[model samples]
Target: MPLEEIQHWTWVFGRAQQMMLDYSLREIEKARTNDPETPMSGFAAAGGAMLKAQTDFWSDSLKLWQRFLMPEEAPSEARALSEEIGRRADRDKRFSAPAWRDSPLFDLVRQSYLLVSDHLLKGVDAIDGLDARQKERIRFATRGFVDAMSPSNFPLSNPVVIEKTLETRGENLLKGLDHLLSDLGRGQLTHTDSGAFEVGRNVAVTPGKVIKRTPLYELIHYQPTTPQLMRTPLVIFPPWINRYYILDLNPEKSFIRWAVSQGLSVFIVSWKSADAGMKDVTWDDYILRGQIDAIDTVRDLLGVDAVHAIGYCVAGTTLAATLALLAARGEADKVRSATFFTAQVDFADAGELTLFVDDDQLSVIDALANDGFLDGRYMAATFNLLRSRDLIWNYVQNNYLLGQDYAPFDLLYWNGDTTNLPALWHRSYLTDLYRDNKLVQPGALSVDGTPIDLSLVKTPAYIQAGREDHIAPLQSVWKLTEHFAGPMRFLLAGSGHIAGVVNPPTSGKYQYWSHEGTAATLSEFLEKAVETKGSWWPDWIRWIEALDDTRVAARAARMPGKGRLKALEDAPGSYVRAR
Candidate 1:
């Protein structure tokens, strides 16, 4: 065999060897299911399950027809199948179409698909030889298959698609074809209309000035809304994986706007999207160069000893390391208070996002980044696949099947916007954090030669997590409390990662739960937690106020073009506009 072919088969065989090491053959035999009806119960017994699935499918189809022929009679064999379909449709938006229930042929399509999907997942669960991580990867792969085969994704199978075609006299298909071609040109599935929003013009319009610029980041000092300003300035360290505009997206939904209005000076780190030039940047460089550089600039420009800090998503992960770095350097007081938005410090239960880090997939990704940067499209696709039904297929059905244009949504626009990761940083992030699970360990990792110890971080922290967050599970975010030495406040918010963090008071959307003190587990905290009616922003600002409410007369000192650091341009600086 050729050398490359031998290597490929070796990697494939390596997975089988892993199962042997992870579990004993005796355990696998003991745990193996004997249930004949359990489709594909175990790999060893797959022959029986395959025969059963084929016979069952035929048997169920016959029963469905019998039930249709005889109306008011005894209970039908397909009654359980009918009930399952109804239950799935109740919670899932995809099968909620009226035609699905009212029409027989369409209903049959939906029912058959659900039956197979359910069994496929169940079969994955029944498999005995694999570990939890291995099983999860199987389930994820199975779900992709199920989601792709969904009746709603195809024009012929979907009732809505047929209706649109007939109503538009086949014009919908023509439009759909055009949309498909356009999306192909863009090289991504568009969740929102292209050119829907522009930074500094409409979306990131909360008035601010670019006070400082480094190779890694641009610091924006937001124009304060109140006549009197709080003593401590607020700096937001958004993840370099995305543009910083998510926090500053439009005046209404912008968290930056709401914070500025509450008499606080806000500074944001606008990360330069990685290109070939940034191939050598590492995690430590991100901490010291991007985050730390932004922090020190805010201090130097505002003349404050300490500043309030906020980190979202991956930045939150980096922020935890930055705090530990600061503590090791005896400069913990540089940040007066810390707030984390849907960030994960502990990768122990990092949710479905870990699938990319498994099954020797990291090596493939490393090779792809041979140009010094991993294309942001790879990361975007991973996130979209997490909720493929909504993010991927929803667009496929709407744009290619039913022929509809994307709506102008700021959040969706931001979600579609991609940013590249430096190859070294990407590799370190996977091996060090996701693979070795080292960030939570004190001194297991180092930044600029200093060992990191999270237990030494004495700064008060407000950690907010989304109950529905898939990328960073609530349980995973909760683990950060165990690592921090500071008094921590954990707030559970409604919605997923982005909506939960960007929720504003004026919107009057979504609720939050806050507990007075820490608990042994998240469940324990929820037992005594108080559930509020609106956004968590107001409650959060009050927490900041309690820390230091000292106010000083507002000065008209924020001219963008004139400062010590000096404004290179405006708020959403050129760095964010890169690629």
Candidate 2:
């Protein structure tokens, strides 16, 4: 509020303003003018939606006022409100400040906001003139704005911020502003204690050697832990969108480390954070040179006919495509068995993410990626919108209002660390797979001059999905069963995308449900599946072993940096270290 403080902000804004690109400014202007990218539905549908929201909001306000005027004994609304007060989500740490519960003024404010938010959020459903994808965009944009304007986000309205400011005699506000300035300088929000963790030293610390390096990715071969090694090596293709260290966050949460310990030679792909040069790298290159080559290298290095493969998220989706490509080329024998983690093959039931690649917004995405590669921050920001209340606003309140530092969270660190996607790869992925739903359509997609057909992918498969996964909806993941002719087993894990896959048995967190018999739908699968508490890693290990539990005497590692597969570097290679 002081002149000096205002002067500091002006200087900061001046510097930031000078650096703004023309395209960025154009985007801002487009947004201001209600751009065509995210068009408002027809006047009738939108008008009706606003009317409904307004009516409900005012009606709820009247009910609240009536309750205050007439002192009634346990009214239904009062009882419901009391029950909601005891409910867990609102009672979580974000709103744990005493004033939120104790202060009548703040309680009414929170309740009013919730009532309006609920109506506004539900306004975009099944609009007459809009398609499913367009409706999703409106819904997402509405939620973003609503979440941004929450009482908890602003210092004056937020109880925790007010309390902190009083407790620290306004010093918290100073620190909060400083944190904001620092984040602005960094060009991204700080989600974790960045200084606390380094990739190879702590997080991706599993002992492995970079056996193969390429333009797209570096393949790491984890040292075998068990005395006897599985004859068929296990190769994992993690989503190129994020670094592979997510599977190796730490020993306890490390999926790679555990797989290695279970008498399996684990080879994982660490994808390069692509630069502008890779803008022309098509999906074919990613399929053939990136994932296929990694598996082939593992086979060549280990002298194996086939390797057991696992794919996570988009990598899982790509694996489905790769399996189809392999099948089309009559080389399906290369991958012994396939396991998918929250991989969506069907876009028909694809959830919120479809909002980004809808017809209108696609042009905007294309324009943004005109520089060859789409900056990952754009995708990261969109993902954050999925759970903005928790992922974005809560962090904003904590980091900027309560004057708290973003805490050290391994998962959040990985979430923030994103990678650029080549323009062709990004466009083709969004258009063919996501928008057009081609993977399920046999002969619809061609990778490396082969018309890929998922039905021909007869490799025995294990598909696991997260019940709460927002990115890859469980239903879409379940749809993989319909197209693949292979014997398939589907499992549902308790958490979202990351935790569900990185789950370790040692931690004893999250339950996984498995159905022995093949079920047609996700509902039928979940209904019959027995819920087993703890990680699904053991179940997967047992399943993968049963395919062919042939064990060979474990081979010792060659001298450091001396062998034919001469280790490029230990464990995580230079590719992952690319910013």
TM-score of each: 0.89, 0.88
Give Cα distance to truth, residue 21, candidate 2, Å: 47
Total residue pair clashes for candidate 2: 0
Q: List CA RMSD, all candidates.
A: 9.4, 9.7
Residues 1-579, candidate 1: write the lDDT tens digits: 254553454344334444443443333334365545533345446444433444444455444433433334415555765666667865567888897777655665676578668767766776666789988999999999999999999888889888899999999899889999988897888888858788778888888778777777788888777888998989999988888889888888989988988988888888888888888899988899888888887787767899999999999999999999999999999999999999999998999988888546888887789899999888898899999989999989998888887789888888888988898898889889988899888889999999898889889999999989998999999988889998888999998898899898989999999988668788898797899988999999999999999997667453334557666676787887778
Question: TM-score: which candidate is best?
Answer: 1
The per-candidate count of clashes, in order, stands at: 1, 0
* Regions of candidate 1 where Cα sits further than 4 Å from its true position: 1-66, 69-77, 556-562
Scored by lDDT, the top model is: 1
Clashes in predicted model 1: 1
